[model samples]
Target: MPELFHKVLKAFSSMKAGVLLLALLALFSALGSTLLPDSFNHLILFNILIIILFFNLSICTFNRCRRIKRLWGAGTGIIGGLRQWSLIILHIGVILILIGGMINNWFGESATLRLAEGEQALIAQDKSGVGVNIQLEGFEIELYENSMPSQYLSHVSLYKNSKLEQQSTISVNHPLRYEGIKIYQQSYGNLVEVETEGQGQVDSSTVLEGQILEIADSKWQVKVFKYVPDFDLAYGMESKSLQPNNPRVIYSLYQDKVMAGIGAAPLGEKIEIASGYYVEFKGIKPYTVLKVKEDPGLPYAGAGGILFMLGVVLAELKIFSKPGQGNGNRKAVVE
Candidate 1:
C-alpha cells in the first residue's frame, strides 16, 4: 500500500500528469458548452477533475519548494534565492486561484431576473435565507446621433420580505450589491402582456417568452412559447429584425399539465381557450435582465491574481551577480 501510495504521489507531481489533467478539463469544458444544459462548474466530473488538479498542484508545489529550500541553503546568492522563492510563490498563487474558484463555483448563488418597469420579482435568497426581491421602478435608454442606444440604465429597489432594503440605479458597468449579491443590468428585451377573462374571472400579466403565467387561481396557465420582434409570416414566421416592427407571439395554454390550446397572433389579438374563455396579447413593454450572483471567493481569486503578477515581476528581477563576474559585464542566464 505504501508503494502504491508513493507511485500515486509521484504521478500527481509529474508535469505530464498536470498536462493531461488540463486537457481533460478542456474536454469537459467543450462538452458542457456544446451539449450540457448547465455549466462545467456545475458538473460532478468537472469538480472531480478540479480536485485532482488541486492535489496535483499541491504536490508539485511541495516538491518544488523543498528543492528551492535546498538551493537557498546551499548559498545560491540572494538573487538566486529570491528567484527560486518567486517560483514557489507563483505555484502557491495558482493553488490559491484553484481553491478560490472551487469555493465560489460550489457555494455561490447565481440567478437571472427578468423584470419589467414597475414590476417586482424574486431575485434570490441571501446566505441567511432571507428572500430578496428587486423592483424595476424605471428604465431609460440613451440614444446617439444614429438612433443607436448609447447606454441604458435601470432604477431598481431591493426588498427583503416586505421591507424595503435598498434603492439604486444600476447599469452595464455599475452594479448594485446587497449582502454579497450583485445585480447587473445584463440585457434588455420587450415583454408581452397577456390577459385572460373567463368564467367571471379576469387576470393579466406581463411575461417574457417561455414564462408561465397563472390565471384564475391556477385554473389555467398560459405561456408565450415564442416571440418574434419583427414577425415576417412570408419567411416561415421568422423575424425580419430584432426591432419590434411587427411584434407577434406564439402562445400555449395548459390545464392540469394538459395542453388546452395553442395559438399564434399579433399583439392585442385574442384567442379562445375554451367556450367564453379568452386570452389576448395585451401589449408590449421594455424589460431588463439582471445577473444576480453571490461569489465569496472573488476576493481570494483577486488576491491570488495579484500575487501571481508579483511573482512574475520578482522572477524577472536580475539585480545582483556573482562577486567575480565583474560589474555589469557578465550576462545573466535564465533557466
Candidate 2:
C-alpha cells in the first residue's frame, strides 16, 4: 500500500502532471461551453471529469509526501508536512464548492413582476421561505442619440407582508435589494398604445387597449383598458390628424392608475392592435435594467477557490525540493 502511494504521489507531483492538469482544465472548460443543448449528457460527463481531477490531485499530493521524512534535508521534511496539510484542506474545499454550486443551480428561486407605475406585487416563491412585496412608483426609459436604449430607471418600495421596509431607485445593473430578493431590470419594451379616432362610419369600434403582459410559447394576452373612440388626453385637445388608413389615439397604460407607457397609434392595423397595447411605433428607449440575486453559497465558493489555489502552491513547493547528494546512499527514488 505504501509502495503504491509513493508511485501515485510521484506521478501527481511531477511537473508534467501539473502542465497536463492545466491543459485538461482548459480543454474541459472549452468543451463545456461549446456543448449544444443536445449534448447535455456529454457536458455532464465532462463536469464529472473536472471534479475527479480536483479530488485526484489532492489525494496524490498527500500520498507523494508520505515517505518524504526520510529525505536527507530539512527542506524536504518541511515541504512534506505542508503538502500533507494542504491536501486535506484542498479536498474539503473542492467538495464544498462543488456541492454549493449544485445546490444553487437546481434549487434557486426567482420571480418576474410586470410592474406598472404606482403598482405593487408580491414576489412569489423563495427556497428560504421568505416573502417580499415590491411597489413600483414610476418607471422610465432613456434613449441614446440614435434612439437605442440608454438606461432604465424604476422607483420602487419594498415591504414585508404589510409593513413598509425600504425604497430606492433601480436601474440597469443597479438593483433594489430588500431582505434576500434582488430585483433586476432584465428588459423593457413599448407596451403598445391603442386608440380610435374619427368615428366615421366604423363597423365595430371596441378599442381594446392594454399591455401584452407576457410572450411565451407563441401565446399572448393583454390587459384591456376601457374602449373609447376619442380617448381624452392630458395634452393639447387631441390632435385631429385622422387618416383613412392611419388614425392616432393618445392614451397611457396604467398598472395601478399610473402611466407605464404613453404614445399615439393608428387603429385597426393588425400590427398595432395585434398584441396587448397598440401605440404608434415610436422607438423604445433604453431603461436601466437590473438583475437581483441572493447567492448564499457565493462566499463559500470564493473561499474554496482561494484555498484550492493555496493548496496548489503548497503542492508545487513539495515537488521541487531537490534531494541532497549523499556519500554512500544517494539514489533516485521513484517518489
Candidate 3:
C-alpha cells in the first residue's frame, strides 16, 4: 500500500502528467463552449478534469519547491535559484487563477435591473439572502451624428434600510461599486405614456412603439405607428426624424376595423379629432438597464495575473556572466 501511494504521487507530479491534464482540460473547455445548454455529463466531466489538474499542479509545485530547496542548499548560485523560484511562482499563479475562476463560476451572483427614473429595486432577490436597494435617479444618452447612440449613462443611488448610502453615474465600461456589488449601465429605452378622454371617460396607458392600445369602452383603438425624436415635414408629408430635438409620436386611429386618421402629435400636446375624441401624448420617460454582479474571487484573479507577469520578468533576468566575459557586461534575455 505504501509503494502504491508513492507511485501515484510520483506519477501525478511528473511534467508529462501535467501536460496531459492541461490538454484534457482544453479539449473539454472547447467542447463546452460549442455545445448548447451544456449537458450535465459534460459539466461533471469538466469539473472532474479541473479537480485532477488542481491536484496534479499542487503536487508538481511541491516537488519543484523541494528540488529548489536542495539546489539552494548545494550552492548552485543565484541564477539557478532565481530561475527555479520564477518557475515555481508561475505555476502557483496559474493554480490561483484556476481556483479563482472555479470559485466565481460556482458562487458569483449576477442579475439585471430595469428601472425608470425614480424607481428602485432590490438586488439578489433570489440568492445570497441579502437585500441591497438600487435606485435610478436619471438616465442620459449622448447621440452621435447620423442619430446613432454614442453613450448611455445612468445616475444611480444606493440605499440601505431606507437610508441613502452612495450615488454615482455609471456608464459603459465604468461601473459603480458599493458593498461588494458592481452596477454597470447596459442599455436604455423610452416609455411612451398616452391618455385619451371621450364620452365622459378618461383612460391612460403606457406603451412602447408599435403597440396597439384599446381606449376604455370605446370603439376606437389606437396603434403607435412610429416614434420620432425630432418631428419634421418633408415633401408636403409628415416625416419622422431620429434627432431627439422635438419628440413626437405618429399614431393611427382605427374605428372598429377602419383606419380613421393618422396624425403626428408632439409630446405634452393634446390633439383633438373630428370624432369627438381627444388624445394627449405625455412626455417620454427613459428606462435604464443595469447589470449587477458580485464576485468574491475577482481579487484573487487580479493578484494571480500580477504574479504571473512578475514571474515572467524575473525568470528572464540574466544574472550569470558568459564564459569569457565579466559580470559587468551581462546581457538580459527577455522572452
- By TM-score, who's the top model here? 1
| Reference-based TM-score of each model | 0.73, 0.50, 0.69
lDDT, model 1, position 12: 77
Model 2 spans with C-alpha error above 4 angstroms: 1-93, 111-114, 124-130, 142-150, 195-294, 312-335
Residue 63 of model 2 has an lDDT of 52
lDDT (0-100) at residue 315 of candidate 1? 78
Q: Could you tell me the lDDT of residue 173 within candidate 3?
A: 96
Clashing pairs in 1: none
lDDT of 1 by residue, 1-335 (tens): 99999998898788789889989988888888788734668888888998999898888878877876766676556676677678778768877888888999899878888888888988787667988889999887876776567888999998898799999999989999887778888998777788888776888777777888776645777877878777776765566655668878878788987888876688877777777677888887888888888888888888888888988988777656566633222222122
Please give the RMSD of candidate 1 to the true structure: 5.4
What is the C-alpha lDDT profile of model 2 across 1-335, one tens digit per residue? 99999888777656477558657767766665676532332356655655556566556555545544445344544444555556556655675675555444445455556665566777743566666777777777676765455877888887776677788888887777665457888765333332322212112222223433322222222343322233345424332221122334344444444445544544444333233433222222222233455555566677888887877776555344546522112222333
> All candidates' lDDT scores?
0.79, 0.52, 0.76
Evaluate model 2: give its TM-score: 0.50
- Clash tally for model 2: 14
lDDT (Cα, tens digit) per residue for candidate 3, span 191-232 = 789898787577888787778877666788888776677677
- Candidate 1 segments exceeding 4 Å error: 1-4, 124-131, 161-163, 195-207, 210-280, 319-335
Candidate 1 displacement at residue 265 in angstroms: 6.8
